[model samples]
Target: MPRKKANETKTYVLDTNILLHEPLAFLSFQEHDVVVPMTVLEELDYIKDSKKDVARDARISIRSMEDVLHDATPEQMTEGVTLAGRGSGITAPSGKFSIFSDLELPEDHHVFTSNENDNRIINAALYLQEQKSPGQVVLVTKDINMRLKAKGAGLAHVEDYRTDQLISDIKYLSKGYHTFEGRFWERVKSVESRAEGRDTVHTIAKNILPEAYINEFILDESGEFAGLVESINEDSLEILDLGVERLMSRHAWGINPKNVPQAMALHALLDPHIDLVILTGPAGSGKTLLALAAALEMVVEKNMYDKIIVTRSTPEIAESIGFLPGTEEEKMAPWLAAITDSLEVLHKNDENVKGSMNYIMEKANIQFKSVNFMRGRSIQNAIVILDESQNLTASQLKTIITRCGEGTKLICSGNLAQIDSNYLSAVTSGLTYLVEKFKNFSGSATLNLDGVVRSRLADFAERHL
Candidate 1:
């Protein structure tokens, strides 16, 4: 393959994982040719009717391709068809979208003699590289091994599918709080403090914390100052003073904060003013426990919401769940054991732990729901806890978040390091996307619970493993 010039158009060969990662991935290659190999389509076809969670995505990808090529004849399909873009909101590609029949590729042109699907896809890209000589051909896949194989097989341009990746590195991701070196007040030259009903509001110059956004927490190394960014202006910021002692003393359904991070997470979770609270951290960091405790406090004690809906997505949890024998909640019980374990810990001291757990589960009206069943419904006056959200795609998160109607609050908790999806990384996780996108939203708050309060052993494992 030749190097692609800035003004020249190159052909992009998309692997099945790319389409599954983003159904409209073809349209994402703006103004560039996209070629879908027959083997890729065959893989999609095989996955579409399966019990896997990505089956819907495969079907959507197939429908999108059909919408564009249904009327085109075989000759035009092989040659290429113009992408309409339609209602996709993406700019129509100036180049063409075509399908290639890898099965018909001559054995003489084969890069690998194996009939494996990956080899077939690589062979297709190699064939295109040969046929489109002098024109750059890139294989876009999410599989790192696949890219290595393609490169080793002599394909010049191989890249990861990163069209949806927001940040180049995870270190740049927001931790929801900024800690100053010494005392935060010592560096401040000017400050304006006033009483707002029952709370004190301080107006400080924006340059002090230039990147501060609404509801972002601000702290100092002195361990005495803690404030939340209430509002931001071009020149200044309005910070709501949250005394560190008060923040540490906050509790949710008898669950007290074990550290400053947990305290901040609990404060965000219990805030009725904030509609969306996202929690990210390592395993054993109390992400799920805090979220669940807060949900119970709001739903059962404060009556802030009518019900608590718990949902999480893992490849095993989302697939073949219908075959389980029981009600929806029962079917989800095994997958949502973390939530139940938290419930048990919350009521472990009761006279009858089992009875207390049952009573609280009923009293709170907590419902365990599948992500698949959560779509196409208006969730009103409820608290939705989406656990293990790092495994989800941006589109998948959008589907669930958009379902929240009026009076609904969503608490998304996930460990970016523990993403189970093959196509997702810490940088590409939907949880990361939500945190970055909603950081400035006044009604949303994000927190990274850095401490592992689950156990001392868990903390050691989190650090070493």
Candidate 2:
């Protein structure tokens, strides 16, 4: 065993799940040494052949390892290989990467007989710590239980890999809307409005507006007189008037907005200029309903889109059903009950619309597709509604959003508080990521609905239980 020098870099032993979450996460560690345990490699080998996104990530990581260690000899691999200048589309890692296959734990060690992959990985980190200094070895994993085990095994360092985490605090995550009260409301009202093309723009002092992103909603304290921040200069802010009355009057397949957030959501959904709309809140907040209603309106009444493409992550439902039998749409039928429920609600509203649900489904040209098969396809002239988006990872969300082609608008709806993915949280959910990233984009809008309009029971449960 050797004592670590003051300038010696830390060694990070990565777990399989970290690489599966982000194949190129090693590049984020800067100059630290990254070690992959042999057990992790074996797990990745088993996973790489699957058709899931994790399998794709495993393959990408393995390929990246090959690209970096292309010319390295067997002896060189045991010692370590430089990962410098090998990263694609990102800054190269400036540290060494090595595979830790040799375990030298004591016979009486508590984890010696554990036989679990996590225990084996933790043993590797322990070996690294015993060979070097206590603080020199760290176990980096996404698994909370594994991290706890590492800490209990006398490991000095353990941390979650945070490469994909854009925001540290969930509260700081923008809701994409701000309300002004008292004198601030008066100042906003005083701002002169001028016609700019099809939009009415108002120029106000930057101090009055403080901080706002492009297309972000600005409402008065009474929830009336809403405007969208169109542009911002150093001293002045330009806001485009959001005609709430017009949005309220507009019906989408016989469904009109019931609240302020719903109205803003409708405005974003109906506006051709807004290519991406994100609706996030608790259950019964009308996220999916508003999105589906808007899709029906745009595709059926306005002929703005050729079809309505609906998809959602079905991890929970898939586990329950195990093996589903049918065509793609039929296989996705159970998971898309939300879509059917919304359609039924819409049908109940308008009896004059011939044939009700049948006519709406036929005339709207709706398609139920799986998110699993959405890769490598261009969705053109469609309103793509991605329901239950909180279940998707950031990478998966990126893949789904990039599938949008010309004349396509994407509506992403999810309740961050109700994330079904085991690996995701309110702060790390793809919905939160999109809301944070696209807030500044002029072509995107985000609406965080507050109240639950479904029923008193649902609202009470949401508040108390």
TM-score of each: 0.95, 0.93
Residue-by-residue lDDT tens digits, candidate 1, 17-86: 9999899899888778999999999999999998777899999999999999999999999999987544
Q: Distance (Å) between predicted and true CA of 172, model 2?
A: 1.4
User: What does the lDDT read for residue 159 in candidate 2?
Assistant: 89
Compose the digit string of candidate 2's lDDT tens values, residues 182-238: 434566545777997887888988888677778888877664577888888888889
Off-target runs (Cα >4 Å) in candidate 1 are 1-7, 84-92
Q: Rate the local accuracy (lDDT) of all candidates.
A: 0.91, 0.82
Clashes of each: 0, 0
User: Candidate 1 clash total?
Assistant: 0
Clash pairs (backbone) in predicted model 2: none
- Candidate 2 C-alpha error for residue 401, in Å: 1.3
TM-score, candidate number 1: 0.95
lDDT value, candidate 1, whole model: 0.91
Q: Give candidates' CA RMSD values in order.
A: 2.6, 3.2
